[model samples]
Target: AEFEIPGYLVWGALIYAIFGTALTQWIGSPLVNLDFQQQRFEADFRFNLVRVRENSEQIALLQGESAERQRLSERFGRVVGNWYMIMRRTKRLTAFTSSYAQAAVIFPYILVAPAYFANKIQLGGMMQTASAFSSVQTALSFFVSTYRTLAEWRAVVARLDGFETAIKSAAAEAISTSSIGVLSSAGRDNIHLQKLLVNLPNGTPLVSADSFTILGNQRTLVIGPSGAGKSTLFRAIAGIWPFGSGSIAIPAKATLMMLPQRPYFPVGSLYAAIVYPAEVGAFSSDRVREILIAVGLPQLASRLDEEAHWNRMLSLGEQQRLGLARAFLHQPQYLFLDEATASLDEASEAALYKLLEKRLPRTTIVSIGHRSTLEAFHQRKVVLRREGDRFVLQNQAEGVKSSSDAPLA
Candidate 1:
């Protein structure tokens, strides 16, 4: 406007800008989707590589080098394939923008020459008109030039949005009012379940515990046939499972810990890993060593200062022993062993049970095992019998009632 350029030049520039922008967006539109796929593919391939690295020993033992190479190649193939698509799309966009820029150099001359030839404007006026038109064209093509960057940024934003949405959705589902309710009951000596029905994520009822109470300071064993939702039952009491309805009223201020078949140990010093979920210095090194020795891990007694991935370095049986050591150190009010000792020999399992009985007699020990040897350790037995599609918790101490009658499922 300041240049006093011809109105026709402005009109021509506007038309050129509008068409350029449309074409740029049209050519680059797929880049957003392509970039998103590229990120996902890259992540998947990296994750597969990590998985292979973590399981390198197993792969080597199985002599699966050829199989793994093929698997990794397939994963990398997707990454390369999507990158090519992005490259092609970007090339097309670049070509169009390059031509558009070259055309813009002379576009002002074409518009102003008419006025100059008609002897209506001076040569300086023609030069000034072209300059002004070029400036406007640059401003308008700014979006076109930065379209690739914008697409990648948009793809990142989309992935972040999706990640946040998934996390929020999981949180929402976990706390949904329709799911099972876990509450702490004041002045209650026992853990109680009233009208509790544990269901799978798919809304299938797995176990029904209507009126169950686990008396304080007692050992209990839970046994059921395969696929009887044995582990799922304990998950409900831990307040981690949310697929069911009704309420589980745990004793007030009772500390509970569930030791799964595979216990997770952070990659750190043996002392830190053993007392995990507890700070490094929470338990004195001497105390952790004693606990480790008591758990029949005397071989690891002097290795408290050793830092490594205990989960990977130790065998499953060794890991289970470490898990027991953790329980002994933590001394939780209730300890649920979900086949935690299954890896150990029967004698070793018996010895651990004896140790628990002697050391933490007040702590309620709940074991889920198939061995008849477990019954000798527990005063009570809770069995899950398949009725229809789901299993119902039956207490041998009581009668054949649903989950509510039994203390632990």
Candidate 2:
């Protein structure tokens, strides 16, 4: 009877072990999927927060703080609510798994106890029977215990698949729908636009020009009303905005630079911030100091080694001056200023323009500004006027001819 009882216990253990492994895998898969999905949702929510922070200034100025806050709150609320759902599901799964495991330990003993009690096995035999039964049940219950993890894993796979799809869609759209072509113009004399059409982000026509050419080494000023597509035109020239149909032929060897009203400064040493598009050692330390002093930023000359967030460290006016100092150092063949000097006073702005005229006479200047003071620096003016649904550039006749009309030597 003792030997018979041991045989029965061994048989029970074998059966439990076989079933437990299969069940554990089945239950664990869903839990892993759920956890993975939760992580993806959390990442997306954080990305939105970064977007809000980057545009906080504009939002605050336009009194959009409440709206942005509400939007962010809605996004975060979804994240929290989804996480709670996932947690609850996990809790239920854990409860079931734990109970099943506990019951599994005792189930074999309960069944075999009848035989042992019936004088079928010794005490040692009975103890061994129970241990074997528990081992079998533990192995079989693996799936039930790991079900949550499996769910989380599946969720992660789904989120990653979705992100991939989104990236592909964005990339395809960028390639196929844009009409702006960036082509090479090896050593061309002028920048030409042929049958150019500029559009807004929504594909609405903003501007159309049949043919235009910006002569080399000639200063040209672009004037337009708000939202008249001046900046859009510039973006088209720079090959960033691809929503328009046109061909822009730039000089092959000409170096072009654009300085906006608010120039971006990297958060690092002042030296690194000054020669941004170039490496830190591109210019000598002394040359950078000289340019800074010339632009009325003598104080910053000593701070070249100091590391800080230059964007938030300097005011808008100071930043504009820094941008001009950069321009002086780079000395590009062509410079486009989109209200780059609007922040400074008229005197300072005039002085900086004069400095450019005096120092870099050969560099062509194309500026977009509302101030009349800017007209004195440029030889030609082009204004954008609204037609039916698009803007057209019209050249304005020059009233006062400057003395230095000769092409730069």
Candidate 3:
């Protein structure tokens, strides 16, 4: 009878151990998925705040602080609510697991007590039975304990998969029918656009042209109303805005640079910020110093090694000057400016244009600006005129006159 009781206890333990382990593993998968999702939500919440801070100036100028506050609050509220739900689910799982563990500890004693009372088992036998039963239960209940973790893990996978899908979709849109193709130069001295059709994000036609060219080493100014697609043209040339149909033939090995109204400055030393898109050793310290002085920023030359948030440190005028300094250093084959010098005074703007002409005599200069004073610096002017729902490029006779002899518009 004693041997029979020991055998029965061992058999029961083995049966429970196998079944318990399987159950635990099955349930634990979902909990792991849920934990992963929670982490993704936390990261997304932080990313939103960074975006808001970056656009704080625009929000402030538009008096959208309250609205933005509400929007951010709502976003954070969703994060908090979701976290709370996750925590509650975890709490329930923990509660059940703890109860099951406790019961497993006592269950073996209760089951083998009958043998003990009948003088069928010794103290050692009873202890061994209890240990085996607990091990079996532990193996079986793994899922119940880890269900929350599995769920979190699944959520994380889903979020990451969704983000990747979005990126792919964007890339596809950038390459398909909506994309603009920049072709290799065919020994063309001029930038040419053939059968170009520019469209808005919503697929609304903005500008359609059969053919156009900007001659090499010539200054061409593009003038249009606020929403007339000047900036979009620049984007198309840069190959970033793909919502256009056409081939832009650029010189195969030509260096092209675009200076936007608000230039970007990476967080670092002043010198690093000035020579960005180029390595640190691309220009010597003395060369950078000379350009800074030429742009009326000699004081900044001494602070070359000093690190700071340059965008926040310099005024708009100063930043524009720094942009010119960048152009002076890089000396690209073609330079496109989208209202790049709009922030400076007319005199300063004129001075910068003259300095550019003097320093970069061989560089093709294309500028988009509303300022009439800019006409005197350019050899040609192209105006975008509204035609039905789209704009067409019109070459004004004024464009044929040389800047040196042309009357100021």
Model 2 over residues 209-288: C-alpha lDDT tens digits? 88988888777889989889888788888877778787788877678888988998898999999999899899999999
RMSD (Å) of each candidate, 1 decimal? 4.3, 5.5, 4.2
For candidate 3, what is the lDDT?
Answer: 0.82
lDDT of 2: 0.80
| TM-score computed on alpha carbons, candidate 1 | 0.93
| Tens digit per residue, CA lDDT, model 1, 1-409 | 2447767777798899999999999999999999999999999999999899889999999999999999999989999999999999999999998998999999888887878899888888888888899998888778877888999999999999999999998788778988889998984468888898999888999998879887788888899988898899899999889898999998788899999999999998988899989987898888988888888889999999999988889999999999999999999999999999999988898888888887888898888999877777787899888888878888876422222222221
- Report, for every candidate in turn, its global Cα lDDT versus the true structure: 0.88, 0.80, 0.82
Off by over 4 Å in 2: 1-79, 99-163, 399-409
The residue ranges of model 3 lying beyond 4 angstroms of the native Cα positions read 1-76, 106-133, 405-409
Reference-based TM-score, model 3: 0.82
**Per-residue lDDT over 1-409 for candidate 3, one digit per residue giving the tens place of the 0 to 100 score:** 3443456666666665555546555534445545665576677778889988878888999999999889889778777877776676666556656665676788789889998899777888888778877776666666656655556656767778988999998799788965778888876458888888889988899987779987998999999899999999989888888887887888788889999998988899898999998998899999999999998898998999999988888888899899989999999999999999999988888888888888999999999999988888898899999999999977877635555643321
At residue 9, candidate 3 shows an lDDT of 61
User: Over all chains combined, what TM-score does candidate 2 have?
Assistant: 0.75
Best by TM-score: 1
lDDT of 3 at 330: 97
